[model samples]
Target: MKSFLYPNIHPPSFTWINAEKTQIEKVHEWIKPITNKSNPVECKTAEIIVLGVPLSRSSISVSGASEFPEAFRRSWRSFTTYNLEDDIDLSSMEILDAGDVPMHVTDIRKCHQNIIQASTALYNHFPASTICAIGGDHSITAMMVKGMHRAYPVKKIGILQFDTHFDLRDLSDNGPSNGTPMRNLIESGDVNGTDMYNIGLHGFFNSQDLKNYADEKGVHYFTLRQMRKAGVRETVHQCLEELSSKVDVIYLTVDMDVLDIAYAPGVPASTPGGMTTEELLEGVLEAGKHPSVMSMDIVCLDPLKDAHAQPTVKLGTHVFLTFLTGVMLRKV
Candidate 1:
């Protein structure tokens, strides 16, 4: 196998807190950081590989989303990896935090290329490994999806996008912004538009033009109101069942703005009404455990916009753990 060139760009280093012995039994204790270069075999042997992509230059509006990975890592230190509901402790799993991708400040194209290299490297390193990527912004999803398609060319890839916006706008004039990733993916043929399923699309937050374009392109979508009417769980089950039948593998991309502004005020495009945090968690866990789901990402958490209480940061970290728990419990 060709080894991936690890980017030389500088990003935040993973910092392990020196918590008191009494508080050592948290999720921080479970997450093992891959700070140094490891043997190729060692990298390939991990059950789960977590990587951070810290580029936010194409924010479309708000900036500082690049700081999300570090903020989420910091918040994760305060939680426990053990799931009380599932009665499972994830500390035993072989999980590796592969650190953030080296970001380019001036060249957005270079930053996106680095993301593709990182994703391809991580995915190709292991035959059975599932990846969980922390985002700089939703635009990175275009590169991640492209990377995955490159890594597994034979399989048909399905995308499950959890967000408040369709993100299918044309960016021909502005370059590649976060609002244009899905459109780019469809146009590039990395993933078919019909294979893309979007949930929690909020009213007023998305324009009629985007909705019409999505429908015209055959992108499967459901609004927050539609989801509420059908019940979130049932709505997800219905979508997942139909989606799974059409594609060989599923890649889940979560945009934090999917949640109500009250729940995720830190997101760049957050609005007044949206899905509840619990609804997103349940849907993510359900999808993570499915046989067809191979990789996932949570995007658009701008730490600068977070509340003094840091509720959005806390929720983002918790969602990562929740998805991991579901993956850990998957049947062989």
Candidate 2:
């Protein structure tokens, strides 16, 4: 893996949102195993570790998502208990709240570099561990993939992006931003563009230019309409089978906007008539179960827009927990 320059970035302060004193008390009871005494716990040996990269930059989300990491942590306090069906105890696992990566909101380049630095450190430290990254925005996907590429240079990396938009805009003039993550990843040369696959793309919002670009790059894509026509199970099965043949390591990136606006109104960009929360959960869980999945990122959640905060926090927890269950089952 390539060495990063900013290894000395300060750790993030845990600022919980909407958490009452009693709620925090209950959360701390179970989270003790994950958090450190002086600092948050750093898992030395664990099959999986959840790292919070709450990087909120104005360039990424128009409403700002830097506050998501703290809000998510607070919401997790209520839902962190073990599940009997999965027969897995999260507290028993080598899970750690590595905290958020520091970012210079004024300098977009510096922020991207910081993400690369932090993700690269984690990848190198735990080569075998599955990384569950809590995102700042969809743009962070580019840096995370770059870090993974550095860690496993020989592995053929594939990106499975669950989003409504194509995110293939080549913004050469503006540089890389949240809307241009996929384009930047393809241009980076670390990942094979042909091996990339995007799911949940709906019509009307997507243009022919984006489709042409995807076709030109040999990127595999599936629309929500097509998935509805073929049924979710068959669609997901075909996607996995096709991607498995093209790449050795698969990284899944889920943009909350992929869900219908009614289901995920807290995202920066909400599209109507998209996948439902239940369908997304099922599809993502199935994808996570695949042996090729190495790491995953969930992004574009805005708590401010979420009335009662359930849409952003609860949905985020649901996705994370489902993925965790899938990973545990894969081991068995």
Candidate 3:
């Protein structure tokens, strides 16, 4: 049992939406919480489990990304369980909040180990549940996948990442930064590049070396331009088709920087040229509709950089809602 896991033991706070005397039940009100236990969790009730990893020491750039998971939980108050686009009531769905994996800010290695241990323990206990995570930074993903592989050694996992960068930077010189997770996973033989599909890559954010490395590894990538040209739904379906068919399960990771800087100012590395909010939502919804998608993590959020309106934070929460709505559709 890892001593680093902290379940949401505190009492719930009043939602911002409710302060307005609204009759609608917001997402935070609908979400169910489960305290972390050292023993294997009983898997009879949950359909999805949400884990928080507050880590950022390994980011390639300076950021307050460690504040993201908490920020996301708070942001949950702003959304309703209803999805107008899908005509699905998320109340029909089930989400088990697994609280957070306490991060060791000064020790990236230790923090990663906590993520791996917590992920492996929880996943093994609830093997049938879909795992979802709100991250401190992108680095936690490599560790999470490592745990996934450990929990189910026989399963071949596919990755579907929505990001601006390839995140394939070699860790030889710098060791396990946010920019090196994908490469680290591939190098470790935990995830195959051929089973990975990276979407929303654009701008001058990436390098030729990284592109060459990705190509050499056989990573399938589709740029924002390609999404626009091919249509978001079409491209996503094609990617999901290939991934779901070839791998036993799919892991979806969304780097908030994949959105345009104008819309996602809270993301540490967001740039001018990126996917529109709608494009990203639509893209992830496609992934959620597929039964093979076993896990997802929304990362790179830096709440300190957010505007007073808190658009970025709220948008990130909306991404989860839309995806869950897709899951609801499939369940019905």
Report lDDT (CA) for all predictions. 0.82, 0.74, 0.82
**TM-score, model 1 to reference:** 0.93
lDDT of 1 by residue, 189-289 (tens): 88889999998987687788888999899999998888889887787778778889999988989999899898888988888888888899998888777
lDDT of 2 by residue, 118-223 (tens): 7887788778888878877878888888888877778888888889988888777447877788889888887767888888998587779878998998888888
Per-model TM-score, in order, reads 0.93, 0.87, 0.91
Q: How many clashes show up per model?
A: 0, 1, 0
Residue 99 lDDT, candidate 1, scale 0-100: 77
Model 3 deviation from the true structure expressed as Cα RMSD, one decimal place: 3.5
Q: Ten-residue segment with the worst summed lDDT in candidate 3?
A: 8-17
Between 2 and 3, whose TM-score is larger?
3
Q: RMSD of each candidate?
A: 2.9, 4.5, 3.5
Candidates ranked by TM-score, best first? Answer: 1, 3, 2
Clashing pairs in 2: 36-41
**Winner of 1 and 2 under TM-score:** 1
What lDDT would candidate 2 get against the real structure? 0.74
Candidate with better lDDT, 2 vs 3: 3
TM-score leader: 1
